[model samples]
Target chain A: MKRKISLNPVTRLEGHGKIEIFLDQQGNVANAYLQVPELRGFEKFCEGRPAEEMARIMPRICGVCPEAHHLASVKALDALWQVEPPRPAKLLREIMCCAHFIHSHTAHFYVLAAPDFLLGPDADPARRNILGVVGKVGLETGREILKHRRYAQDIQAIIGGKATHPVTGLPGGLSKGITPGEREEILSKGKSCVEFARASLQIFEDAVLQNKRYLDLITGDVYRLESYSMGLVDDSNRLSFYDGNIRVVDQEGREFAKFAPGDYLQHVAERVEEWTYVKFPYLKNVGWRGFTDGKTSGIYRCGPLARINVTEGMATPAAREAYEKMVDTFGGKPIQATLAYHWARLVELLYAAERLVELAEDDAVLDPNVRALPTAEPGEGVGVVEAPRGTLIHHYRADREGMITGVNLIVGTTGNHAAINLSIRRAAEKLIRNGKVSRELLNMVEMVFRAYDPCLACATHSLPGRTPLEIKIYDSRGNLQERLWQ
Target chain B: MAVKKVVIGLGNPILSDDGFGIFAAREVECRLPAGAPVDVVEASLAGLKLLDFLLGYREAVIIDSVKTGSGRVGEIYCFTPEALRETVRLASVHDLNLATTLELGRMLNLPVPEQVTIFAVEVADNTTFGEGCCREVAAAIPQVAEQVLVHLGIESATG
Candidate 1:
């Protein structure tokens, strides 16, 4: 008899992604899949709108990472009109982008990921949350976090016009330039961010790394996957959030391909599976080798760990040190431990904070000239940016009058769809055995997905505000055995 | 110190009926008499992002779209933060719902509004991508805005 175990945690107005486990006659796990809800007709929805509206509209697609979408859309606009923004605008954009990184990465670590480690993974389900984290880490830390989060938002709001859904993007430049007072304030906030970032790393070192069990779990084989990695790199191959060529590295950490965003189609292809709404993006040259990993397989990972793995080092001094420490601790290059995503996220956070300060102090940040009138005809363009999750790609083709004709976007989370499925399956296989499923075991499975911080159905901002998961286990005789709701 | 009140409209404006909250907030903002002690703002964000806007206010009236799985197309319900605390569980993805965000604000000793009320409208459409709410939801916007004004003890000038 074949039994299927399904996990569907559906929430009102929010998107639903599920996991299903198939059991064979022996009552052993055979295959598992991560299924996300279908958000239909996004490209069809964009046809005939002014291409420039994408910067404003795309941000609404995902309330969580709107800044990432805004930056990517603006970059695509820059490419579409073939205009280069002045130096001040470029620096200003990068500063805001870095601030966005800080806000997102910090929130993910403290609120979502930290509770698992700090409150103990097997802690009471009721207390295993941000409240639990705040309880243990102290309320002062929470205050500091809130303060820095506000600082990041203030920076973004000052630059992008709003915190969540921004409106400052244009074809050649921002709608406005920074003032001297704003620069001074941003620089001061940036310094404070740097301090907070360092303290965050210290907290991780003390709370997570010092604990033997958590450290072991982080580097353990259950969460490990040997796969290629991809991220954005500047001219010197340093990890860069904005303005860089796309870089891909093999499992051994050798550079595989580095190409401009316009050539993305030639290097990458999306594989649509009948099981899920999310598409699996894979390298075209290596081809799609199923859901498996390794050099021969096209399944590569993105986000913090993948970004760290693919780059030479962080550009900023403090971040470079943090990167070296992490690389050394992990025993070398190509750290396949998926849980290290949290650690790599911290390193990136430090880099972003440092970069924010560096850019604020630069003289050109106060330049009066920000926009250069775009003169090029509307055509096809591609914009790539390293979002908090991973590489965010926005491609658009517009008519001569600048109306959008076609749109294709490979969001950061979608890039890791195949890898996420593989990770879920690997965790399920190891934790679920003999047709038994426990809450603890299920959480372990969830930890794998949580590490990716996958944001399917991200664009919508409905009320009650959360994604839900429901898990149902069936016995080998096709009888329902257990159900877990979260 | 005199208390300040803010009415936050929450939801995406482009996602059909999901925009009711925003529209309602705008209605409240437009119809309020001059020198009213209330400020109206719109945000397409949730969780901690929502808390950022609610900070420094003594009271917050949140207007947003809600789906309860029942067949009410445009019915509106009022709720307190305490009432929501019981139902808002920690999400598997994304940190903090409304209840937790407020809870954390208090725990951190932030000036979270002492009184928090949520005005949720049951809507028919939230997934469809378009501007403006569906007719049923759009009809409730003015009623909801007037209700918010009355809740604040401020008489509507337009009425």
Candidate 2:
């Protein structure tokens, strides 16, 4: 008899996901499917609005990374208006992005990922949460993460005029310029944040390298890698957070293509399925290939690991050294294991803190003229930004009156949707094939979802109603043998 | 000493009428008596963080955008903390909701104010970018500010 085990509403991640495992005659794992059940219609709704509104409206798509959307929207508007914001405005935007990176990544690592780490692989379901982690691992670390989040939000509030959905960024430039006193205050806060990030990085590194069992859990054989990876790489081939050309590289670190933000649509295309609302973005050159269907065939991964792999080295001096040392210990090639996401995230944190300090102290940042007057010209435009999760793209078409006639948004999570589902299914199959399904195995499958760091809420915000996850198993004769609903 | 009041504005200014809270908060800030102990805060929609600002005050007036079916654009609703506690369940994706944060503040023995009022402005077109407030909501800003001033026991000096 073939049995199908389904994991629905996978917890501890931004959006929702479901995993279905198909078993063979001996109950061995045959295939696994992971599906996200929400659809985002902002692209369709944005068709008739003004191009400038993209900056304002798109940010609300996700409460978590609104700044990313805001920046991308502004950039797209700039492209349409055929103007460039002043250097000071660009620097301030980078500073704001750095702050977002720190806060968002910290939230994921501590509140989301740490529960599984500190609470133990076999922790009781009731006790496997942030509150439970505080009890098990102590309050100091938890408090530190919370403090780090607050400090980062403070940076954003000061710059953007509010913490969550900032208002300072505009199409032509920033709405307000920063005063020297405010700059000094931001620099001071940033200094303390660097110290916090450094300490937290140490904690993560120790967990991965020092603890034997923890290392075993993270480097489990189930974690594997293939397909091409993509991220922002600076002109010098260094990992860049803010502005750079995108680099797509294969698993062996060979650069496949280097393209500008506006040309992303040419290299990437969206593949929609009738069963799920999430759009699977694949390399146009590679064609329709499923995950685990071979590197030459299917869609691949993006975000932190892909970012580090594509770049020659880290941007900051300290971060470059750290990356080199990490690679030396882990032994190169792409860090395929999902748990390595925590490590890659920490590496990015180090670079963000270092870069923020540099940008804060720069004199150009205190320039009085932050924003230029808006001269609206109707045209086509595209803006791309590295959201904390992955690359986010915004494209708009406007008429002479500055009204938008079309809008296309390929969010960060949509880029990782294919790999995320495949990885979850792969992990579930391994656990079920081994023996009875335990809560620990369930947590492991959920961890795979977290590893992608999905923002399902943003990817499908306008999805009309709730669509639950459904899983069905078919026998060799194509007979329905089992069904699970969530 | 007289009860001190603070006003908080929440929402994104760029998101058309989503900036209703900020608009009303600004109006209230301008209308307050020069020496009145009122501080206006522009905050993100994070409920727990908003609770932190509410602590240590005698009273607080929160202005925010709402999409309740009972109200149309420019419509305004006022509710006390007790009444809001009864009706506002937890729906936000943030760590907690406004009621739970207040309850948590009370349980922690934090300096939560005894009087808390919320001004919810009905919003339309929350998604349009770069546009000003909806026509109806834009016209109602001064009126909303006036109502807030009267409720706070401060004279509406501007009008």
Candidate 3:
């Protein structure tokens, strides 16, 4: 019998997602799909509001990357009014951006990605979490994770105004500057964070890279995606999270395109799929050729792995050294293994931590002058940033009165939508053999999907706390076979 | 001496009825007597993120929106941490669920609250992006808040 298996509420992901696998009559996996929910009408809701309000409202979309939204929105406001922020203000904003990356990437690597690598994907669902990771690693490691997360959060709250939605960004500059006392506190935390990030990478080396089987899982074909990589980089092609020119590299590690944020519409395009509410973002010049991953398909990826592939190297010394070692281990440029995203994320964590320290120690951080008032007529603008998950784009248009008439946001997670689906489909096809289905098998399939660290906060806004996860299986005849709750 | 108790509201204020907690938290703040023994915090996070809000409190109350599917719109349901533990759909999503977060806090030897209470307001809509809640959920905000007040052993300001 040709049967279908539905895994709704794909567990452990930040927002709602589901996967369905269809098996052939021979019982081998035939096809699979990933469906992501939609929050609906964010653009329409932004309409008719004042332009300046976006910086405050945009962060409400996702709890995981609110700082990303806050920074991007304010940058858009800056572009809309044709104003440049002062050096101190830019430093202040970048400091917060660094903290945001450390906070967000730390959570993804520890809470969502590490459990599988540390505890083994086939481990009991109850034990395959941070708790289990703690149990294996020890109490000290758990406290370290919590402590670093707290440090990042504290830095964000200090610069952004609050831990959730920061109120620090103004049109041309920040609302306020930090005091010397605050700088000392932030500098101390930033120094410790650099060490923490270094330890995190070592943890990965000890657990996954040191183990042959785990290393195979990371570099294996089942989790590999040979596609175009997109990221933001500075003049030296160094990975820059806050602001830079958008650069992309093809599967063969060739520079495909590089353009400024204002010209993004010339490079990126979106495709709608019938199965999911989330839109698939692909390279505009390459053209959309469906979910297939190749130089011709136009489907591209952004985020840690893709960012590393697109850039020359890290901006900091420690991260740069680690980055070179990772590239060397993979046999050179453009590591295509999807699971390597976990490794790339750690490299960026260290860079952000080091960057945090650099900014905190700068004399400009304590400058009293922070604002450059906007004087130009506000009409239209686009702002882009490399959020922890991936590249985020915030486009807005307003009238002369500064009232926003329209808005469009291409969030970080959405950039990897096509890649996530392709990875899941490939894993499902390989893992599910003739007439074989078990919890361990399903979890293995999930392990491939989790490598992307997909955050669906942009797509799902529903209260997810109380909904019960249910999985159902049905035969070709449309009769239900079994139902299981996780 | 100030009370070592705090009230925390969790949800996205722009997501239709999901803003119930933020709205109710504001109402609770206004209704409390001058120098009330409790501090009210409105946050839009869950899992380990809540640990920051729960640290140092002897007792804590969490008010958030929920969609049980079986519950009526605007119905205020009092739930223990154990009940939420059973109903958690996304086991490891954005952060740890409340039960796991608290347990982790205790294991980490953090000063997490000893007594925790969760009050969920059944929601009518949570996906739409709007600052205001739907009419039904908005009506229940005051009543659910009153229930929280009663649980906290405070008299209603209406009296």
Candidate 4:
């Protein structure tokens, strides 16, 4: 007899997804599949639009990380135009990106991921959320997190002209420049943000590290090692969020390759499966590896863990120190632990804040000329930026008349397709083999979903529904035996 | 001379009819006399940030796209601040809509024009990735522009 279990409408993440686990006659897990059911045809729709319009159109990909798309689109256009923006413009764009990182990562850690950490695995389903965290951890921390998010948005709004989708970033430079008064205000806030980030990090450390039971609750038998990792790496092999070479590292933290962003297509190939609209992107050399045991390796993880593994160190002093501490405490190797994503995110938050302060104090930031005057030149260009979730690349080709001829976008979440599916499968196998499915286990599977911090809505357009776990049993001949559909 | 009226267009042009406000603003700007008291500004949705332009004006007209089901594509809905509050749903946090923005402005105790009119064009294709307006909505542009001119007490060519 064969059995199948389906987890439909996966929750606690940005968009909709489903997981299916197949069981053989022996009641053992055979194959597990995870599917994200949304379709966002940004690349197809971008075809035949003006290259300059990419800056405006691409940001609509995600309301959460619009700044990332904006920056990447502008960079691609810059490459096409063969013009580097003024120093002030670059600094302003970087600052805006850092601010976006702080807010986005904080939201993920506190509001989305913290409930799993603080509420314990067996905590009530109803009470396992931000509100529940507030009840257990106190109102001050929750309020502080909210304040940090708002402050980050406000800073981005000042520079980019809006928080969600800022239109200020243009191809050659910014549509509007910041005043000295605005610079002073941003700097002061940047200083306070550093203190806030440090305090938040301390809270997470005390909660997760200092408390042995809490650590055991969240970590025991959760994380698994199976695939290689990818992220942005600076020339010095340090973790970098902005412009850098693409680094792919194996499970043991060995560098696979560091290639330019434009070379991504040569290495990455996307395969479409019948289960979902989200494409399975993998290292072309690995071939068609499925989620489970297969010669054709498929799903792999990206985002924070992959980023940290691929890079040797962090760029900012505070983040680098935190990274060292995390490694030392977690056995000094590439952490396969999904729970550590929160720790890595907080570290990046600190780095972003520190970097923001440094950039704000620079004299070039106050320069009156923040834009480079450039006429429309027709050509092909590529732009890459590291969004909060992962790498985002934009490619555009324009005609001699400056009209767009082609557009190809490789968003951050698409890069993590294989890993997310694999994580879901592993979690499902563990729960099904034990013959028990608790809400906590469901949440754990959801945690893997959260670990990738996927923006499914941005990746694809799909309908929303309830997330339920179902299972079925079958024989070797694909004969249905027993089933549990919930 | 008639009271100078300013019209502002809001929303992303790439998001199809989300650029309705901007389209109407541009059309109204082109129809008015060169030295007319009306100015048109193109802005992304900024809820409170719009106050900088609205202040010190005697009258201002705002043209935006409406998702309401009460009318057809070219159907025009006119409302004052008080009347708009009752009919339109103010769910957006961005200052993209004139109704909620005016309400926020009043709450912030900022200077606001005494006469404010809003022209909302019903939208059917707000999610498509393109710049030009749809055929139905595109046809309504001239009428919407004329309505704004008439509201501002200016002699429009159509009128």
Candidate 5:
């Protein structure tokens, strides 16, 4: 007696997503799917617009990661026109990106990820949230988090003009240059952010790592899956968020392929499924093996854990120390535990903050030469960056007059579609028995999904002005067992 | 002391009916008398980042789109954050939602607006990628702007 249960519109995640779990006759899990509604006609919309407008319009795709889109689009334009942004402008762009990572990762860690650990995962739905985390952590820490977040946003607002949807970058350089006074203020704030990031890691160490039960849950087979990881790396093979060649490591932590953004088509391909609008991307060399894991499956992960797993080390000293501690904690390279993504995110947070300080303190930051005018004819180009979630690639084609002819994008979350589904299936199989689906059991499933931080509505930017999360369970006879709506 | 009022238009201007709120807000900006205390801004964002537009204001009016199954297209609904707090359980997976952000703001004792109003137009098409709103949604913008003026206790020139 196989039965199906649908958690329609998975709760507490970006965009609209649903997961369906199939139960075997004995109530064991058979399969699961993470479904999302895909927004349509994006490439067609960009066809006739000027290539430069992508910097402004791309941000509207997802209000959550607009800064990533803005920068990636600008980089694509620079590549299209064959112009190089001056060193100072490049530093400015990198600093802005660092600020974005700090702001985004801070919100994710405190608001979304912390609740499960701070309050037990099985706690009442109402109490398992940021407000609940604040209650347990104390009001003072809440204020500090908000203040530091504000500081990060302020830095972006100063450099990029607005924190969320920046409009500062152009084809070859930034639209404006910063004065020495503004530089000093940003530097001072960067120093404080470094301190804040350190405190954040300490909190994780005290709250999560110290709890034996939590540690076991994090490393347990239920939450662990072996998959290849992908991220951008600099010349030294350190994690590079702004610019680098794409790197992929196998399950055994050996470099499998390293290629430039322009050569992305040579390595990655998308597999479409009828059940869901979202496309599953896999390593072309490995080929698509139907949502399975291990050395044979082409499914690979992107984002924090992947970034840390594929890279040699963190670029900044404080972040390097944190990275070393994390690797040592995991006992080696290629930590396959899905929950480790949260830990990896914190390390990147520290790196972003430390790198912000480094970039601001550089003498070159004050230089006035920021733009190099474009002279080459417009052509096809691809830009790649390590967005907070994972690797983001922006590809564009343009005529000699710089009008866009075609646009293609590979966002961070889409890369993990297959892996996310696999993790959900594994968690459900281990937890659910005899057609039993409790709130706690369902939350355990969500915990695994949350680790990927998938943005289901990566392209759809719509607001119903409310969060609608519904979960429905069914028995073997196709009868609804329980329904919860929040 | 002058009353600090901010009118925020929330939508993706390139999306079809999703741009209703932005078009309405822009109309409100145009009709307001010169030297008015209102600061009009448009954004394609929500959740914690909204605190950026909402903080440091004595009064704030936010115009956006909402999709309730029963509501008619072009219908304008006025409500407070309390209305949203009760019904919507926002989870961005990638970021915090509005209710959580507002609660966090109160916890941090940030200077969040004391009085806030939301004008959510029922939307027909928010999925398609385009610049213009649907005809019905477009027609509702000026009327919505006038309603906003009434909420502010100010007279519209047409009135």
Candidate 6:
């Protein structure tokens, strides 16, 4: 009789992920499946609504990446109207986008990813958290983190309406313009961010890169997945978060596909599984090769790592140097280590801070000519941006009167859905042995997805749920035998 | 001369019954007197970010949606801060939990309210995406608001 082990962390009533593993007759790990309950009906709910409402409404879908959604929706509106925003508006928009990246990456590195590497992965569960991290780094650093986040959020709030669910983006431009004083404040804060980012990288170096065991873990096999990479890049093949062509690189570090945001339909496709509410997006040309990773497999990774892999180089000088250092550290392009996402995130953080200063220094950012009224008939439009998690695409179709007729969103986490599931399964296969599962093994498996930094709170965004990371195990006959709640 | 008070409504407004908190808070705000010594904030954030809303306030009353699994839909419960012991998981893989955030805030000498009050309304569905609350959850918003007002020592204008 074959046995089955189901780690049902499904106690949280809100939308979350559940993992179930099937065991062979010998009680060895046979296969594992990641089941995610997604918040449904965004597309259906969007129909018949005013297309312009997308800029205002899309952000409300998830508080985590509202800035990404708001900007993408507004850009889509621009394409729909066939009007370009004035240079000042574009500069302001990009500045806000950079701030969004900084605000997001700061929390991610300090609160989530830092603990695993900084305090050691096998550290006591009680001490392995943001509190522990702040405690280890000292009070001043914690204050620094909060203050920098405040700066980033202030910049965002000043330009984008609210820092969380922004409403400033309009069809051809922005609804508001910053005064010279406001611009100066932003510039000053942005300069502080540059210092903070450098200090952060130094912290990463002192905490992880400088530590040999952590470095090995970064370059190790447990989390390594040799998959294709995808992100956005400018004409010069430099990383650009706000705008550019969607670029996909092969597993061997060669250009796989590069196309405009609208051409995303032709290059990528989604695979809907019967077990999970979420859809797995894969490269169309490579075809669906299940959960496997390789050159030929459609499975590809995204977010910070993929963005680093796909782009030729970073835009700003400091970030370019950081990027080169990271690439050199990994012995070249196409880093396959999942733990390297933390390093890539810091590099991008530096880039965003530099970009913020560059944008703020421009007099155009303070120009009052922010809005370019749209006059063209509304139609279909697709907008894409490199969100903190990865590539976030918003495609909308509207009628002549600008009422939305159709909507599609390929979120950042969805891009790496297949790869995330695969990484979890791979770790489980290696760690879990003949009918025995330990706390350490479970955490290692948890760390596999943690590196990807998938925000179920963003993806799910449902309320009335307790905690996350709960596990319930089932025996061969499908009866619950043991449970683990975290 | 009185301590400043804040009423924070948490949860994503676009996700079905999850918006119950926002709706209740909105109702509470609507019923307040012209110069009530309180600040009402509508937020969709949690964890460390949520702490940003609670700073400098002498007292805070948080209204949000919750599912205890054993409770009936539309049930409302008032909870103390100590009741969140089993709550280790955070709103984001990128955030600290309520307890941890408050601890860090006090540790860093950030002005976090000590007199905190939490109220959660039972909901039928939060995973399904739609605007406003659903069914009984929608009906219970007014009552939840009334409960919040009672806790705040304010009488409802309706009754």
Best by DockQ: 3
Clashes of each: 7, 2, 0, 27, 7, 3
Global lDDT scores for all candidate models? 0.86, 0.73, 0.86, 0.70, 0.86, 0.84
RMSD of 4: 7.9
| Alpha-carbon runs more than 4 Å astray in model 6 | A8-15, A459-469, B87-94, B157-159
Residues B1-159 of candidate 6: C-alpha lDDT, one tens digit per residue: 778899999887888887877888899999887677889999987766788899999889998887767788888888865566356343332266566778888989999998888888888777777887878888888887888888988776765
Residue-wise C-alpha lDDT for candidate 3, range B67-124, written one tens digit per residue: 7678788888887787777777328445577888888888889999999998878897
For all the predictions, what are the DockQ values?
A: 0.44, 0.09, 0.59, 0.06, 0.58, 0.51
* TM-score, per-candidate, Cα-based: 0.96, 0.78, 0.97, 0.75, 0.96, 0.96
- Relative to the real complex, the DockQ score for model 6 comes to 0.51
DockQ of 2: 0.09
Over B1-159, each residue of candidate 2 has an lDDT whose tens digit, in order, gives: 666678887665655676788888899988887787778887645444566688889888888776654567788878765565343322223433466557655644568888788787777655544336888888878888888888888886576
Model 4, range B1-159, lDDT digits (tens) per residue? 766567877655655666677787788877886577788876544333455568767788777776654468766677665565343233122212345556444543556787887677777666555677788888878888888888777776434
TM-score for the first chain in candidate 6 comes to 0.96
Query: Which candidate, 1 or 2, would have the higher TM-score against the true structure?
Result: 1
lDDT of 3 by residue, A144-171 (tens): 9999999999999999988778998989
lDDT per residue (tens digit) for residues A1-486 in model 1: 766878664221124467788877766778888877566567877899999999988998867889999999999999999999999999999999999999998888888788888988899867877889889988888889899988999999889987678898798989998889999889999999999999999999999999999999999999999988999999999999988999999988999999998899999999988776678999999999898888789998999999999889888999999999999999999999999998999999999999999988999999978898899899988999999888999999999999999999999889998999999888888998977777788778878888887776463455443325567777767688776666
Lowest-lDDT window of 10 residues in candidate 4 chain B? B88-97
- Write out fnat for all predictions, comma-separated: 0.35, 0.00, 0.55, 0.01, 0.58, 0.48
Better of 1 and 2 by lDDT: 1
Model 1, range B13-106, lDDT digits (tens) per residue?
Answer: 8788888988999999988998898889998878788898899999999998877667478889999867765554566223567878888888
What's the CA error at residue B140 for candidate 5, in Å?
A: 1.9
Docking class of 6: medium
lDDT, model 3, position A178: 90
lDDT of 4 by residue, A341-365 (tens): 7777888889889999988999888
Off by over 4 Å in 3: A459-469, A476-479
